[model samples]
Target: MSQNLAEPVAHDGCLLSDLAAALGVASDTADVRVTSVTSATDMAVPGSLFVALPGARTHGAAHAAAAAERGAVAALTDEAGAERTRAAGLPTVVHPAPREVLGRAAAFVYGTEPGDPRLIAVTGTNGKTTTTYLLHALFEALGVRDGLSGTVERRVGEHAVETRLSGRLTTPEADYLHGLVARMREERVEAASLEVSAQAITHHRVDGLLFDVAVFTNLTQDHLDDYGTLDNYFAAKLPLFTPERSRRGVTLIDDEWGRRLAAEAAVPMTTVSTDPGADADWHLATREVGLDRTEFDLTARDGRSLSSAVNQPGWFVALDTALSIVALTEIGYDLDRIDAALAGRGGLEARLPGRLDPVNPGGEGPRIYVDYGHTPASFRTVLTTLRGFTKGRLFMVFGADGDRDATKRPDMARSAALADVVVVTDYNPRFEDPAAIRATLVRTLEDEFPGLEHYEIPDSAEGIDKAVSLAEEGDIIFVGGHGHRQDVEVRGRLIPYSVKDAARAALAKHGWSTR
Candidate 1:
């Protein structure tokens, strides 16, 4: 894609007539003066151009009256919403697809020209957050101040803003995503690292933005409910590597999917792999992983060799770090500088939650960890990671989220089978039956790891308490699922709940002192 981002100020405070011609919105009377734009009706300001688009369960047109009642200057929407806006006596800007034009239209109204810093986009089924964090760390090591945006949160240098949204949907709405980027540009960040989701591309959320370098970590089982199949899921991630979407591409070739993506990507590309026989431009070797750190040797295809280290200890993260280095160097950061910025980069807090976290610094009790590992792949990895750290039994407390890909329930059970003791609990049930979800997983695990201690605690909070009460010194109690989430979905409302907080509370009640 073109490196030039559409100028935001090109049509700033432009009149309705001006906006119509520029955006190709046809109407008899284009007298509405558009001052701003927003997708959230609750946040709709007076004189703001509120976009009412189609939603999954209902039409956003249903909210047009509410948006107009909130003092929206006009509503830009499809035919149905236009009728509602006009009926409400609010001006209407009709479009075939309002969500598609949101970012460009918002940029037209509020954005400035693109800044100088290189923009790196990281995408894949998993590890996007960790990779982006690693890149930000790499950039910082290279003496570059950068901005971060991903599933975890958004940060510019040392300042971080908590993210309030769904994790399955990684791509924020177009208006918010671009606004964040514009703010980052204004902050003079030398580089911007973002996690691009397949959903983002499919929904046209990041449609107008340009990516300088795109990195693919690896794609595996995920979002199958939305995409419907593995092939469809893979197709969703392919857009970021196309020449029209990125200037350069980096692929982590450890997975067969990554190798295929590297072969098909239209842009100039570099491949990273930990597999010795894989055809990658950069390779990682001589790895070491500890509770607190990991080190590895990197051998570039160009004949340069380097040793690297990270504060994070996941063994699977080795290629992710290497991919970050390749993307940063290709985008122009020097090697030495890259290494330095990453020095201060620590593991994402509570990402794997409670798994590696110490229970209490001084208390004589087993270590406890809380993580959000709902997928089979994640379940297996977390269990394996904890198994390595165990001197005694590895106790796993986890559950399946309701109303999700039902087929994966068996896999999750298989992963939990690896643990010494498995206690099933409720995750976000949303609209689905929580008890049924728990039974499915519990059945799968029992079938494989029969007679292994298993408990079906439908309540997350109570279930966590059970696991902690069962903990003994030198044991590891892992409460998995709901990482970084502070709420639980029951019926339709999200009740306040936190996995990490509960784990800590349970540990404390079980005679463990705070760190």
Candidate 2:
């Protein structure tokens, strides 16, 4: 398998005629020889085909001259882009919808290999990053090198991709994705996992890739700012289960959306469930759960069991483990091998950067936890889990992200009301007023759960300070909304910020020294 990916399995590059014909362009525009396809003009290689797509603010064709100057052989675009490219004195292949075929054209350029790494696509409202992180670690545990693509970072093999970097979007553009996969093939990776966002699916980011298994964690309220409603957001994720998107699918039937997806899936599917009596193909029965360890047994329909223990709570870790197990098993992994590789080390849950990660501030201070749970469902589950383990009053510091789904802010506040104390604050309030955002959340606390004690702060540092100031030795200070984020985008400036630093500072201010 490694040897197969070590060399190209198809032609070096596609003929311009074949590309134009496949894209339904006129045969007259097929005389040029193309060596590659690119979306960014600055990345145009000699003899490469530049794709100029229309954007909300500006057309990509505005940079056609720069791409031509950088040795782009030819270009493809819509009528508007073609007009701009013609003005730039560049030969252009016109298409009505250039993004629809962008991935296919890129695949032709890079030459998709037969033994290319098996790609697994993961999608849901939450747990996407955690699931991909687990799958990446699972591949390592199975002794196969793999690639990881997600919101936090992108890796070709074991190395993080530094060329395009991250944070442009959850998933990169289609051409760049294909290029990254081709690089992974060159590195001879055996498997890869990707976090597919609803926006990525709606924008045709993974257009021409064939996934071995598509895993869905669960669908809930999110991205309503982009999709307008929960149903539309779910519809955006539904396309990933089609035959065009994935070969087979594994989904959690913990929610109605997941059950409906299995029924309406266009490709073959297997169901994984946390409910033992749910008639799922893979059912998880909990045996033990601790603050940092959870033991569960995955029972198949045939009475065979895969007993395992994950180093996390059962509420968040059980379904994720069951889904990944089902996906790997369905993709032809040996059951015995899977059990041996994973069960040997407390299961394969990767220590994700920011999912309920605790910040330790040396002295006998309150145990502080920092997490990235922003949605209503996520807030409820994470709060309930933390609340269950607390001996002292559980306090929370959280903020609603500006320029995101504003409707969930009230729900987040209402959920945080479950805690003994709540501190409302700002997290990356892009153009929106931080005070106004906090006011909205504080208003909800006032109207719904006014009995709980609360405080309001303007930014992350102040929020952490407030939480730490109110905490005793045995209390828990929960910081929510932003976790593992190094910078805050406030009014268009990237200000360096860290919750760990603020927590430590608060400890020092309270006469608690480092141990």
Top lDDT model: 2
Q: Where is model 1 more than 4 Å wrong at Cα? A: 1-13, 32-35, 65-71, 112-117, 156-168, 340-363
lDDT of 1 by residue, 162-248 (tens): 333344456677766665666566557788888898889888877667788998887778778888998888888888777656888
* Superposed Cα deviation of residue 475, candidate 1 (Å): 1.7
Tens digits of lDDT, candidate 2, 349-380: 66777788777735587888787767888878
For every model in order, what is the number of clashing pairs?
14, 0
Reference-based TM-score, model 2: 0.93
Clashes of 1: 14
Q: Candidate 2, after superposition: displacement of residue 223 in Å?
A: 1.2
In the order shown, the candidates' Cα RMSDs to the true structure are 4.3, 3.3
